[model samples]
Target: MDLKPLLNKLENYHTEKPNRVFTMYLNTDPADPDQQGGEWRLQLKNGLNNFETYLQEDGDSDEKRNYWAVKEKVQHYINENERNLKKSVIIIATADEDIWFAETLQMPVKTEFFWEEQPQLRQLKELQKSFPKTGIILTQKDQVKYIDAELGTVKDTALYELDLDTEDWRQHQGPHRADSNLGSGGAKTSKKDELAERFEANRARWYKSIAPELDQIAKKHHWERIYLVGPSDEVNDLEQHMNKKVEGKINKNLLDHEETKVLNEVV
Candidate 1:
């Protein structure tokens, strides 16, 4: 999801009475130690119940009715999505449905609830800053894999391999699995070794060839940070040619790993 547009819209939103917004941030990660024994369920119930009790005691008729409507909707949403909840869940809505936004995010969030004229966005903004849109470039020899991610979740991915004949990078739909035998013990490595040898000879030029595409992808994805992970020489050579700044670099090949594993190890 693109946050720039959504955040801008939410930041300007305001209302009163019937349109009062309800904002919620729930930490639902089962692995989180604090959530052991399904404690978040009780927290959520208590939070909404507190709001209901307060509205019952002191709120005007419209305010109480609106709060009740929003409360029911919120309860239904949570129940429906409980099984699919991720590390966190965020929701902002009004009883009349003038505005509604809900998302299950891979990133963690502190549990909080608000009933106000505008959606509470401080935590969401913090998540955006902490886990901004990122492009992870993984390289080995003549292949490059790009993982586009935001808020700690993989968004999209593509593979690009340099065609020796054309000296041009060819985009592939998915990851290019690394050859398992390349570095295994006692295996004949003539073919791949020869290719790697050839690539090493003109490594600078080859890396330079793909650098422009990296910059292009970063621009297209609006990546705030770009990380390159691969052989030291590949990372250095590519950085020298690319206009985009490298946020981080790791001197090890990880293109063959699972997307989540690679992301955790690299960033």
Candidate 2:
């Protein structure tokens, strides 16, 4: 599809209202499988009403409650703005290696494949490209220090530990954990349920931690559209979850890196 038009649209969207909020999500943890997909990284930003409300509901200490609140708010937003928000675009970024592998394998592949091909070799290359100033390849144990020095304090970013130990993660994937209800069969009702619970917990934690910042951004920019960029599956799930819960105040558009570049051609 034509990307220049999209980029121009984005530029126009931002220029028309300089105060509009733009937010991006980045997976900074190198150890995480999700973060290793790209070299530099990508982010999505848009405007939405009631973003602050979504942030407030995400603070529940109870993981289930937090998940439900966040989902509900998104659904409410979608329901309220069925027409204008439905067309919002989601942007994603994938590295050259990922695209090559997917085309080569003729199947969807993860970045781990490239890393496994030549762990040390690829690691060195990536590290060099990631921080050209660093002359040597640092060990995994030294990653935190290297990142802190190269990227500055990690605290400023949306980076944190995954709470695998939580019950939410143990039961269902991140998107559906809150809606789970224990059945008589127990044992998670099924393996699918268990995976869903885990995903929900992981995602909930990430969202909760970042919601406050998002709220501030929304308020600052007075956003009316939201773009979500990430792994296709994750972005789809997030959109579904939000639409089911938030109502009609937000619109979601999903797009991959190449598609995004095309969409943002104006920039």
Stretches > 4 Å off in candidate 1: 53-80, 95-98, 174-176, 180-186
Error of 2 at 56 (Å): 64
- Per-residue lDDT tens digits for candidate 2, residues 172-227, read 12332212232222355566476555555555444444334344433333333334
Q: What is every candidate's alpha-carbon RMSD to the true fold?
A: 2.8, 26.1
List clashing residue pairs in candidate 1.
Answer: none
lDDT (Cα atoms) of all candidates against the true structure: 0.85, 0.27
| Candidate 1 C-alpha lDDT tens digits along 17-50 | 6558999999998899999888889999999998
- Lowest summed-lDDT stretch of 10 residues in model 2? 137-146
Q: Give the number of the best model, judged by lDDT.
A: 1
Model 1 earns a TM-score of 0.86
